[model samples]
Target: MFKLPELDYEYGALSPAISADIMQLHHSKHHQTYVDKLNAALEKYPDLQNQPIEDLLQTLDELPEDIRTAVRNNGGGHYNHSLFWKVMTPGGSQPTTELLGKINQEYGDLETFKSNFTQAALGVFGSGWVWLLPDMSITTTPNQDSPISEGVVPLLGLDVWEHAYYLDYKNVRPDYIKAWWGVVNWSKVSELAQKS
Candidate 1:
C-alpha cells in the first residue's frame, strides 16, 4: 500500500508564499485521502501491490476494468502530490546554469517563459495543473491527470486546484500562481531537466 510521503521542510517553511495552515491541511488531509483510497482499491488485486506509481499510470489499460478508474484518480493524485511537495522549498533555490540556459534558448528569456507558464495555469478554468516539460514546453492537465499517463514526464508542475490555494488566496488564482514562483524548487527542476 502507498503512504503519504513526508515533506523535506516543515509545513511553515513556505510562509507568505503558502501558508502553514494550508500546507498542513492539503498534505495531511487531501493527500492522505488519496493514499488511503488508492490502497483500498488495490487491496483486491494482490498482483498489483508495490508497483511504482509511474508504471501503474502507464499500464492503467491493463488493470482490471472494475478498479482502473479508482487507481487512475487516487493514484494520479498520489503521484502528482508527491512530486509537488518535492519541488518546493523554504526560500526557493536559484536555477542551475544549464536549466536557465535552456529556458533562455527555448523562450527567449526566463521572464517570457514564466509569463507563458502562468498564462497556461490561469487558462485552466477548473481544477487542473500546468506543467513545464523537460523539452521546455508547457502543458496543462485536468483534475489529477498527469502527462506521464501519455508517456511524457514533466519537469515541473503547478497545481491550480482550488483546494491548493482557496484558503490563502481565496478565489484569486492568479495571485496564487504569482506567489508560487517564490517557493519553486528550481534546483530539483534542474535535476529533472538534465535527467530527461
Candidate 2:
C-alpha cells in the first residue's frame, strides 16, 4: 500500500515562510488522504500493486479504465507530495555551481529563473503544480497531474494547490510563492538536476 512519507524536518522547521500549522495539515491531513485513497483504489488490482508509482503514471493509458482516473489523481498526489517535502528544508541551501550553471544556461540567471518559475506558478488557474523539468524547462499540470505523465522527470516542483498555502497566505498566492523560496532545498534540487 502507498503511504505518507515522513518529513525530514519538523512541521515548524519551515517557519515564517510556511507555518507549522500549514505543514502539519498539509502533510498529515492532505497527503495522507492521497495515500489512503490510492491504496483503496488499488485494493482490487493486486497485479498493479507492486509496480512503482512512476511506472503507473508513465503507463496510465494502459491501466484498467475503472481505476485509471483514481490512480492518476491519487497516485499523482502521493508522488507529488512525497517529493514536495524533500525539496524543502529549514534553512534551505544555495544552488550548487553545476545547478546554477544549468539555470544560467536555460534562463539567463538565477533571478530570471525565479521570475519565470514564479510566473508559471501564478499562471496555474487552480489546483495544480509548476515543475522545473530535468531539462531545465518549466511546465505546469492541472489537478493532481504530474510532468512524469509526459515522460519528463521533474527536478523540482512548487505546489500551488490552495490547500498548500491558503491557511497561511490566504488569497495572496504571490506572497506565498515569494516566501516559499526561503525554504527551498536547493541541494536536493541540484542533486536531482545533476542526475539529468
Candidate 3:
C-alpha cells in the first residue's frame, strides 16, 4: 500500500510564496486522502504486488468491475503526489549548468520556458496539474494522470487544483504560478532527469 511520505520541509517553508494554511491542508488533508484510498484499493487486489505498475495498469480494465475506478483514481493519485513531493522544496537552487543548457536549448530561454509552462497550466480547464516532464524531453500533463503513463519521466509538477491555492492566492492563480518558481527545487528535477 502507498503512503504519504513525511514532508522534508516544514509547512511554512514555502511562504510567502505559498501560505502555511495552504501547505498544511494540501499535504495533510488532500494528499493523505489519496494515500488512504490507494491503500484500500491495493488491499482489494492482493495479487497485484508482483506485477509492474505498467502491467497492472494495462490489466485494470480486466479487474473486478467494482474496483476499477477506485484503483484508477486512488492509484493515480498516489503516484502523482509522490512525484510532486519529491520535486518540490522550501526554496530551490538555480538550475545547474547541464540543466540550464538543456532548458535554453529546448525553450530558447528560461523566461520562455516559464511563460509556456504557465500558459499550459492555466489552459487546463479544471482540477489538474502542470508538469515539467522528462523523456529526452520537457512537457506538461493534466489532472492526476501521470506523465510516466505516456513514457515521460516527471521532473517537476504543480498542483492546479483550486484547493491548492484558493485560500492563499484567492482567484489569482497566475500569481500563484509565478510565485511557485521561487520554491521549485530544480536540483531535485535535475537529479530525476539524470536518473532517467
Candidate 4:
C-alpha cells in the first residue's frame, strides 16, 4: 500500500500564511484520501505494478472510466503532494546567493520573479497549482497533475486549491499566494535543481 508521507514540519508550522486547520485538512484528509484511492486502484490492476510510471500513466487514460478518474485524481494527488511536502521549510532565509543569481538569470531580478510567479499562481481559473520548476521555469497545472509528467523538474509548488487557503484567506487567493513565499524552502529548491 502506498502511504502518505509525514510532513517535515508540524501542522501549525506555517501559521498566519497557512493556518493549522487548512494544513490539517489538506494533508490529513485530502492527501490521505488520494493515497487510499490510489492504493485501491493499483490493487484492482495488479499488472500495473510492473509497468514503468510513464507507461502506467499512458494506460491510465484507457482504464474503465469509473476507475480512470480515481487513478488520475489519486495518482496525481499522490505525486503532487509528495513533491509539495519536500519543497517547503520554515521561514528564515532568502535564497542563497548562488540560487538568487540563477533566479536573476531566468527572471531578470527577484522582484520581477515574484511578480511573475505570483501572477502565474493566482491566474489559474480553478483548482490547480503554481510551480517554480527546476532552473527557474515557472508553470502551472490544472487539478492534481504534475509538471514532471510534462517533462519539467519541479523545484517548488504552491497549492492554489481553495482548501489550501479558503479558511484563512477566504476568497482572497492573491493574499494567500503572496504570503506563501514566506516559508518557501529555496535551499531545498536549489538542491532539487542540482539533482535535476
What local lDDT score does residue 127 receive in model 2, on the 0 to 100 scale?
91
Q: lDDT by residue for model 4 over 58-145, one digit each (tens)?
A: 5666676767777777887877888777777767346778778989998899899989989998799899988887668788999987
Q: Model 2 reaches what TM-score against the true structure?
A: 0.98
Off by over 4 Å in 3: 49-64, 136-139
Candidates' C-alpha lDDT: 0.93, 0.93, 0.76, 0.80
lDDT of 1 by residue, 4-66 (tens): 999999999999999999999999999999999999999998879789989999999999999
Model 4 pairs in collision: none
Can you rank all candidates by lDDT, best first? 1, 2, 4, 3
Give, for candidate 4, the lowest lDDT window spanning 10 residues.
Answer: 49-58
Model 1 misplaced stretches (Cα beyond 4 Å): none
Question: How many clashes (backbone N, Cα, C below 3 Å) per candidate?
Answer: 0, 0, 0, 0
Q: Between candidates 2 and 4, which one is better according to TM-score?
A: 2
TM-score of each: 0.98, 0.98, 0.89, 0.89
Arranged by TM-score with the best first, the candidates are 1, 2, 3, 4
How accurate locally is residue 98 in candidate 4, as Cα lDDT from 0 to 100? 78
Candidate with more favorable, higher lDDT: 2 or 3? 2
Give the higher-lDDT candidate: 1 or 3: 1
lDDT for each residue of candidate 3 in 1-196, tens digit (9 for 90 to 100): 5567787889898898888898899888888997787667667678865455545555667777887777667666767777776777887667778888888888888889888888988887788877776643445556577665665667888888888889988888899898987888888888877777
Instruction: Tell me the deviation in Å of residue 156 in model 3.
Output: 1.0
Those runs of model 2 whose alpha carbons end farther than 4 Å from true positions after fitting are: none
